[model samples]
Target chain A: MKARVHVMLKTGVLDPQGEAVRHALGAMGFDKVEGVRQGKVIDLELAEGTTEAEVAEMCEKLLANTVIERYEIDLD
Target chain B: MKARVHVMLKTGVLDPQGEAVRHALGAMGFDKVEGVRQGKVIDLELAEGTTEAEVAEMCEKLLANTVIERYEIDLD
Candidate 1:
């Protein structure tokens, strides 16, 4: 089984890294861009039969800093 | 309009950061965890009426590095 997890800063957090990237893109000429935020994705090749709840539990227990981030999961 | 974009490394790419994260999680005692891959998410608050194609074009042109990653966009 395969699981795809996306982890990102919670809303209202300041993302300096994202801001830097935004500035970089502007310099690279993508000036239509007006906002930028950055987060993270985690791909897992799980043992067959891994349940969505198991993955969600993993996110809560280890994969995410819940104080600063939230996560979404996709199963494939 | 809003778009949720997920950007991630292509298969076969070596993601040192992800490897490090996996190791870190292991150290944190989540031993059922067997693998990890890290990517990024970019959220866009677009002006209403933004087409999917336009968002995809933005991704191809600026939001993702196609040589190293693939992206998925969701409109909401």
Candidate 2:
């Protein structure tokens, strides 16, 4: 089974990396680019019997920093 | 318009960060986790008239490294 997780910064959290990307785009002459928020995607290949709950636990325990980030998971 | 771009390392490319994460998961006892791949997602808020081609151009120009990375663009 495969699971895809998207982890993004929570609203109001400071994202220096995102800001750096925005600045880089600006320097590259992408002047119309208004805002840029960067996040992460993790693709996990798990054993067949692994449950969604276990995958969520993985996000809570290590994949995501809940204090500053939120994650969404999709299983296939 | 909102565009979501997912950038991932091409297969056969070495991903030190993903390996680090896999190791970390193993250390935390996620023994059933087989493989992990890490990627980036960029959320872009563009002017209403921005075209998908333009956004893809952004990825090719600066958002993703085409040599080792491939990006998928979704506009909404």
Candidate 3:
């Protein structure tokens, strides 16, 4: 099985890295850019029979900082 | 308009950060993990009427390093 996780900052949290990118884009004349939020995507190759709950546990324990970030999991 | 860019290291490239995560998961007893590849997801809020080609250009010019990385753009 393969699992993909998308980890993103909570809406209220400040993202300096994303801010930097937005600034850079503005400087480059991509003025249509109004906002930017950067996040992480982790693709995991797992042994057969791996469960979504197990993946969620991994996110809660290590993959995401639950306090300020949120994660979504997709299995394939 | 909104655009999402997924930037990932090309296949066969060394992903040390992903390797480290896999090792850590093993240490935490998530033995079913076979491999992990980490990447970036950048979400952009754009002005009205922004075209997909414009977003692709952004990826080519600034969002991704074409030498080692590839990017997929999704416009909404």
> Best DockQ goes to which candidate?
3
TM-score of each: 0.76, 0.93, 0.98
Per-residue C-alpha lDDT of model 1 across residues A1-76, encoded as one tens digit per residue = 7888888888899989778867876797655556778887788877777789988988898788999999999999
- Measured on C-alpha atoms, candidate 3 has an lDDT of 0.96
| lDDT (Cα, tens digit) per residue for candidate 3, span B1-76 | 8988999999999999999999999999999999999999999999999999999888999999999999998888
Ten-residue region with minimum lDDT total, candidate 1 chain A: A25-34
Using Cα atoms, each model's DockQ against the true complex is 0.51, 0.80, 0.91
Top candidate by lDDT: 3
Order the candidates by lDDT, highest first.
3, 2, 1
RMSD of 1: 2.9
Q: Candidate 3: give the clashing pairs.
A: none
Candidate 1 A-chain TM-score: 0.94
Of the two candidates 1 and 3, the one with more favorable lDDT, higher being better, is: 3
Candidate no. 1 TM-score: 0.76
Give the 10-residue window scoring lowest on summed lDDT in candidate 1 chain B: B24-33
- Model 1, residue A49: distance off in Å is 3.2
List residue ranges in candidate 3 displaced over 4 A: none
